[model samples]
Target: MTATASSPAIIRGATLQPRPWANGLGISHNIAQHGDGACGFGWMIATAELSGDAAFSHYPGIDRVFTIIEGQGATLTLEGSGPLRCRPFVPAGFPGDQATHCTMDGIPGRAFNLMLDRAGWRGSVTAQSLAAGHRMSLRATAIHCLAGQLAIGEDVLEAGDTMLPADNVTVAAQGAAAMALVVEVAARVG
Candidate 1:
């Protein structure tokens, strides 16, 4: 009954509507909203048509980290850190309300998002491309395939395969065009 890295987590179809943002800042959120702040432990999602030009903003209740899923180039100017050039597959963490902006050098695509509630849980995320039989060195509490195709053991995850960790064991992907999203969550009780 346990979910594994080789299986599809939750396959979410593309949405028809858009989320709120400044003009020309259209985006779509594929988030699981069941736990805290529209998420189990937190919110996990992907965003489309994000501002590629240092389009920084703030969320009132969620601390967020973003991964540049696809695009030519982009940069993030944080409130208390150095400028982050949005590189594909690179995960960057920031304060929920920290002021920021982004600029890109190419077209925009789906950018993955992982948000944690400021008052409760803690989490981190990353996106990596794995060739058939290739593996990742990072270990965490959970991981999911957000895009592309993937296979772990006997299961095949096409786009949304989610898996729970096994004693912090390392999970790997074994197929072309294999990309996975890793998240580690621990509840923070106040």
Candidate 2:
């Protein structure tokens, strides 16, 4: 099933289906189904305890960006590089195909993850908020707000709101108290 939307053009929202991998290290699924204009991108919200002992190999075709949402604290090591301590709300990424490990001292937290094939697509997730009446006119990719309230168009979207932003994607916020995220998905051009 797909839900379609328009800000001028038609957009759609597909349900995030469940896909279990890594022997249940975690669970994930595509929020969007098959192509209906919006394609070549992957989004997964992760809810799991951090572990380095799991021993993860490189993801051959996927490029991933991870943003911590809730947790104590964790460290991510990229092969030769030393561990980078990660806190809640911070986002980071590297070649998914590279040897990577995540370790936590005590408990695990939640994180948002977006993974796309390095060749056909690319994407990013941020923990910042948008101000009311403030329009970001960046022309690179599509925009979607997964959390927070956005004074978009004329409505205040409270989490799980979205938009496909290219050039000319403009909106006037209703109030200054509004805040949200602008996730851009862009096509990789050779």
Candidate 3:
């Protein structure tokens, strides 16, 4: 469930378990979390599946980024901002404490989520696609494969596999189609 700061961790999708939400509207599978769910955490990477509409859980002092990993995606209605349309591979960043609700894309889908404590850490999410014979410099903290396969360092990742790569590791596509979601999390600068 935890990895040292100096090493990378490979999280297999098959090992993840569905964690039911308090509201019972959706479920989340934690890929990596810094603290106990009952208490608080510094950062967290999770895969969430929503079958219908629901309000996002409030996390005070946290910043969150969400990317659609499957299906058509959804729409996020924020309190002050205009509605944000989230499509596959497009990551959206928002304040975790905002009064937010999501209207599903009429079909069940999953999203990759990153949550960081605003006071202690910050995070970003990006989508990556690579063609064969190309190399990608993976400086991000983690990556989740969405299509094809990637050879990152010594590991080969297929769709749904999450890898926390060492700093500055390089990645390459094994075939013609390779895509993933990259996440970077770091301590907040003063």
C-alpha TM-score for every candidate: 0.69, 0.64, 0.91
Per-residue CA lDDT of candidate 1, range 8-35, in tens? 3343344324675533456655544326
Off by over 4 Å in 3: 1-7, 35-39
lDDT of the candidates, in the order given: 0.61, 0.52, 0.84
The segments of candidate 2 whose C-alpha lies over 4 angstroms from its true place after superposition are 1-18, 33-58, 131-147, 154-156, 161-179
Misplaced by over 4 Å in model 1 are: 1-9, 13-18, 21-24, 37-41, 51-54, 79-82, 134-142, 146-148, 152-155, 160-177
Q: Which candidate is the best by TM-score?
A: 3
| Candidate 2 lDDT trough over 10 residues, lowest sum | 32-41
Q: In terms of lDDT, which candidate is stronger, 1 or 2?
A: 1
- Provide the lDDT at 98 for model 3: 87
Worst 10 residues of 3 by lDDT: 32-41
lDDT for each residue of candidate 2 in 81-109, tens digit (9 for 90 to 100):
77767776667777666677777646655
Candidate order (TM-score) = 3, 1, 2
Best of the two (2, 3) by lDDT: 3
How displaced is residue 174 in candidate 3, in Å? 0.8
